[model samples]
Target: MEFSQLIYRKQRRWNLFAIAAIVSLLLFSSLYLMVGEVFISPFSEVTPLMEQLVLQLRLPRLLTAIAIGASLAVSGAVLQVLLGNVLAEPGVLGISGGASVMMVLVLFFIPVFATPVGFMLAAVVGALLFTLLLVSFAQVARLTTTRLLLVGVALGILSGAVVTWAFYFSDDLSLRQLMYWLMGSVGGASWYHHILTLMLLPVLIWLCFKGQVLDKLMMGETHAKQLGIDVEAVRWKLILAVSVLVGGAVALGGVIGFVGLVVPHLLRLSLGSENRYLLPMSALSGAALLVFADIIARTSLDSAELPLGVVTTSIGAPIFIWMLVKNHDSR
Candidate 1:
């Protein structure tokens, strides 16, 4: 296709997908805020206590979910483009793993930093540390793409092993409480948590605007550099972006897995792999899916709630298999 024609096609896809995602997100988010323990209609008659519930509880939770979903999806899309692998995600770079390890430390070893703010701080720091380490490795080792990806996967596994050891050996918290952090949840949502998550929006926005550059990188590093893109600098920026977003997400929602992995792939199948459309659309769809999954997590059980990560992974696993099979058959 001609360059102009490709641009036109991408724009059309963006408009259509954006419209669909907005409608779906608004509908599901409204439903989410309404369908709690007390089934209150969003636009119907209300009481003061109900209003308080909506404001203090449901509203913050919904916002936090949106932030987490959007951040993960965009970061995942960026990583896929950067690493040239569909399986590339937040975990592939160990961002969430680093965050999880820090959270474990705060929960047990550092009692002074057990608050929400403290956890968020520690998580971001750990995430940045691992991300920078990866960048340094990429630079120093002059590793090929496949080798770099392997290194990232290895780091993530190492981080997970450390977290597992901490969870099992420590007696600071109950097994159930610590396990939920690993599985992921938004039940701890509050305005403070919401604010901490919102700080990542600027990074996400900057990344969404980087679709043109990312699209070039998708071609190949040599081709992208020939096209006047600073391939190395963009890689560093995107690495940092993914790290911060994933770190914040882990802090806010725990290690919610599938948003980063599945959202971008689903949109790629439906719309096309043009990053311009994929990035923003992924944000919208991610928000919608997370909010919807959260509703299932909240209402699935009669008495207690299910972990959000389990819910997403359960839903994503089958869909991921189907996607893989379809790709295989198409090839």
Candidate 2:
């Protein structure tokens, strides 16, 4: 009876936490739409200009933030399970890095393919290729978690080197444009970007609903196989889904880092490690975090906007360092 009561209390707490995360997402999203450079009151008398500004400019950016945030967070959660490493994330695994590298190459060398759709497609393909390579390492090479992480870090370094060379060789105008983008911002978001968001949503929803599969996989391959889970097939499907998600996020937000790494880690700490709850809650929490971060990015300065990546990295880096230290100490 005591054990049953304890389980009930824990379930109630998790339910309440989920409700709070959802509420926070909605609240932050509303605040984001209202509190930009020009504060437009939703309750106030209508102005055509205000409506246009709200609908045309802010709404798309908000949607981009929400979509990219949810995508990256869910991808990270699933990657952690797929890789069997708590530290796994799209950015950390070189998925975002690969997407960014492809985007930069296309923008610089293949000017004809510099359109938004073209960029998204390039990013998706790049992410998919990189994900396949990592999957091979995990499945075929049978690398350990630590070695896999090292390989991922090496891929990220290689991608960074390529980006740096591109930065060095570009003319002044292209340099400035690429610099701003690589730093990351959603300020360029428009109705056109909504197509990318549409591409992301189904994959995000599908991944979120895979919590049971993730839970079984979390127990290791042998255990998952014993439970009638086809580990190899599921991993491939998940890799494809994660590629789409990470690719779309990089295309939408321009190499935003640490969101995928940070949001799920924080949720895991407070909410426990049940993927069923963790995945959806990570989506809500991640969306809220990015929206809040964007609010800071645009509004913090008077004239110039700060890069969205800079703001997120600033917030996430410290938490990530603490996490690293904690993990080491625990060991």
Candidate 3:
């Protein structure tokens, strides 16, 4: 194929992907609104209770899925580009682990700090602290990308230990609550959570879009500096953006892993490495994936909803393994 033809073909493919994502989103929304305790047929009957369930219960959950999905995917895309590592994700980098630890602590030790806003603040602080520690350790050790990954893995293990200890010492009720949160569900979503997520989502999206300078930086930090980009300043801003996005999502929906990891990689494979297309495509695809996963979680079993985390992990693990295998084969 000629170069121009190839370019046109790729753009057409992306357009198709975008259309498919929109269709999936609409189908998921309809399914979410229609499937519940009382199946309300759209044309036949519209009762008050049905309206409550659709509007009050399901709408918030759907919106939360969209927010968490978009936020996590964007975080993953930015981190991967910034670190120059395809495997970099919020969960792998210890940000999610740190947020999870603080959330568990709040649930156990501080009853007054159990509100959504309080939990969000705690998670953001913890994520930022851990991110700083990781950066410091990287600088001290003169780390490579591989070394950084190992360090992040180690930090995640340590944070897991802290979370476990917190759970062990907490009351039974608190422990149960913590366990449910950790499992990850949108069942408890409310309008307040929706509002909070909506407020933060646009700002994070803007920051990620603005940080496309990282694409040039991804070639090498030295090259970026030579081109007049303030490398340190950009890195710190990206870190802050990731903290707010990931921390807010974790605070509201607990730690839903693999959405970040999976979404960005898929986008990169299908759409190439351009951050502009990659970021927005990842957002839409991630939102669609999470909404579909949540629907399966809610409606798959008879009268027993599965945890959203379980659903994502079950689907994500196999995909991740495949990607790893493919990467290995390519080398």
Candidate 4:
């Protein structure tokens, strides 16, 4: 009876988290659409220009935020479990940096990547390549969590150097575009971007279903395999999914940081580490957080919009510092 009650209590908490996330997502998404450079009331009549603004501009941007937030947050959660560390953001783990490097390389050299599919492929290739490098390095060095983070940082620096080298030879227009992407923005989201987002939503759903397998993995790889989890296959599957998702996110939203690092870790601490609740909640909370941040980024300054990364970094950097301090003190 006590065990059943405990299970019921856990379920209740999970439901509450899901409800809160949904409510927040709906509220913020509405605010994101309605409150912009000019306010548009959802119920009231508006001009064609306003209608177009909401449909063509704000909606796509909003959806892009959702896609990026959900994917990055989930990816971060998965990586934290896979790497057994808190500092597993896409940017930190070289995933986003890798994508950025490949993206710039393609933009500078490959005219075919001017298309959306080519752009996505380049980012995926970069992310996968970096994943391989990270795995190899970790295995070769027998990396502890700290060492893994350091290696990831080194990889990121290397990728940045490559991108910087490309920058010198690139034209001014490409340079400006690349800089905007590096900084991150949803200002330019279009129907093409929406197509990518739609394709990705199902994949995110599939990832959420991976929660059970991920939960098993947290118990240790050997234990998971003993329990018939196909540990290695699951590992590769998740890494590939994360690569595609992170690659898609970087391609779509540019290297927006900390959503993955911050969101999942916080959720784990607050709500408990059960992936079933954690994964879906992370997605919703991530979407809400990004929408909130994006709102602040564009609207905070009069007649000027800020980059998404600047806003997130300003907020996340402090949280990150606090996390490190707390973890260090605990140790």
Candidate 5:
């Protein structure tokens, strides 16, 4: 009876938290649309200017932010479980770095592939290749989690070196564009990318439902196998899923930092380590966070917008430090 009551109480708490998360996402979404340079009241009469701003400009950006945010957050959550490390994320794992490097190379060498779609495809391919490479290293080297993370860091450094070389050779126009992409911004969002954004919905849905698999894996590979889970098969599937999520996010948003790292950590601190609650909440919370961050990026300056990555990094760095400190103290 006591155990039953405890479970019931936890469920109630989670339900309330879920409700709050939904409300927060809705609130931020509204603010994203309404609180830009010229503040428009939600209840105000709609003008043609307002219509264009809402539909053509703000709506797509909002969707992009939401999609990318959720993708990164969920990816981070899964990665933490897969790698058995709390600090694992797309950026930290070199997935985003690989994508960015490939995109930059294409932009510098092949001017014909300069379109958004081309950039996205290039990023996905880069991410997929890098993911496969990481898997190969793990399999061949029989590395531990810590060693694997170090390998990822080394790969990220290699990617950075390649990007820097491109930067050195790029023309002024290309240099400026590359800098903006590295800094990250969603200002260039367009309706043409909506199909790609919409396609992520099914992927996100599939990932969310894998909470049980993630939960099992958290018990370690040997234990998970004893529990009748095919650890190797599941790992590959998850890696592929994460690669897509991270690649799509980098492709759309240009390496926006810390969403993956920060969102999952915050949600875990609040909701505990249960993947079932953590995954969906991370999705909603991540979407809200990115939308909120984009709002700051849009309105923080009077004339010029701040880069989206700058805003997120500024917010996430302190939280990340605090998490490190807290973990150390707890230990």
Candidate 6:
């Protein structure tokens, strides 16, 4: 096929994928609205209780799930492209670990600072610190993407140890709170949380979109320099943007896993490796995945709801394992 024809075919595929994602999101939203205890069977018979549940409770949760999922997924896509590593995710880079550490500190010291804003601020600080540290390590070591992944793994392990120590020394109530946060859930989602997520997501998404220059940079530092792109500046900016995005999501919903890893990898496989389309498509696909997961979390059991992280892991781990096997085979 001609190069122009291939480009058109790729664009057509992405357009169709985007359309399917929209339709899926709509269906999931409708399902979320419709599947509660106070059931309204028909559209005409929808009552105040159902409306309240849908509008006040379900809608906020749905929006939060979408925001968190999309943020993490977009961040993942950006990191993957920037680092030129398919395995790179926000959580893998210790962003989530950093957030968890700050959250644990707040719970340990100033209990009153456990509010959403305080939590978000702490998470951002932690993530930014880690990002800087990681970048510095990369520079000093002249690290490859594989080396970056190892560094991230080490950081994550160290942070996990810190969190474990904090939990070990805490009281029952504090430990309980920390456990819930670590496991992740959308239980406390409110209009305020929704608003905060909405406000941050757009700015972060725009930054990721702006990082198209990094895509060119990935060809090599020499090539990027030739093209007049400041490779180091772009890398730092992408890191900061991802830190904020992932940190905010962690603050709101705790340490939900796999959405970042799962969504972007799936998109890369389906839509090919263009960050422009991969970023948005991953966001949409991630939102759809989390919304569906949340629906299962709420309605799967008898009285109490399951943790959203539990549901995601239950689904994501097998998929991840399968991908690992496939990757190994390909290699």
Better of 4 and 5 by lDDT: 4
Ranking by lDDT: 2, 4, 5, 1, 3, 6
lDDT per residue (tens digit) for residues 1-331 in model 2: 9999988987887899889888898998899889867898879997998889889999999999998888888888888888777777877778888999999888888989987788888899889988888877987788876688888889888888888888887777966686687777899899998988888888888888899999999888899999999988998899889988988999998888888889888878876888988899889888989999999998999888899989998998898778878877877
The candidate, 1 or 3, that scores higher on lDDT is: 1
lDDT against true structure, model 1: 0.83
Question: Which regions of candidate 3 fall more than 4 Å away from where they truly are?
Answer: 1-7, 135-147, 172-174, 329-331
Clashes of each: 0, 0, 0, 0, 0, 0
TM-score of candidate 6 on Cα atoms, chains taken together: 0.91
Write out the backbone clash pairs for model 1: none
lDDT of 2 at 204: 88
Q: Write the per-residue lDDT of candidate 4 for residues 73-163, one digit (tens) a residue.
A: 9999998887777777888777889988888888878876666677778888899888878777666777886788888889888988888
Poorest 10 consecutive residues of model 6 by lDDT? 36-45
Candidate 3 local lDDT, 92-171, one digit each (tens): 77778898888777766796988888888888878878777776766677777667878888888898788877777767
Pairwise TM-score winner, candidates 4 and 6? 4
TM-score of each: 0.88, 0.94, 0.91, 0.96, 0.92, 0.91
Write model 1 residue lDDT over 69-110, tens digit each, in one string. 999899889877866667566765677888888887787778
The alpha-carbon deviation from the true structure for residue 78 of candidate 3, after best TM-score superposition, in angstroms, is 0.8
> Which ten contiguous residues of candidate 3 have the minimum total lDDT?
203-212
Question: What are the Cα lDDT values of the candidates?
Answer: 0.83, 0.86, 0.80, 0.86, 0.84, 0.80
Q: How many backbone overlaps does candidate 5 show?
A: 0
- Candidate 6: which stretches are off by over 4 Å? 42-44, 142-150, 172-175, 326-331
Model 5 lDDT-worst window of ten: 322-331
Model 1 stretches with alpha carbons more than 4 Å out: 1-10, 92-94, 129-157, 174-176, 323-331
Q: List the lowest-lDDT window of 10 residues for candidate 2.
A: 174-183
Error of 1 at 237 (Å): 1.2
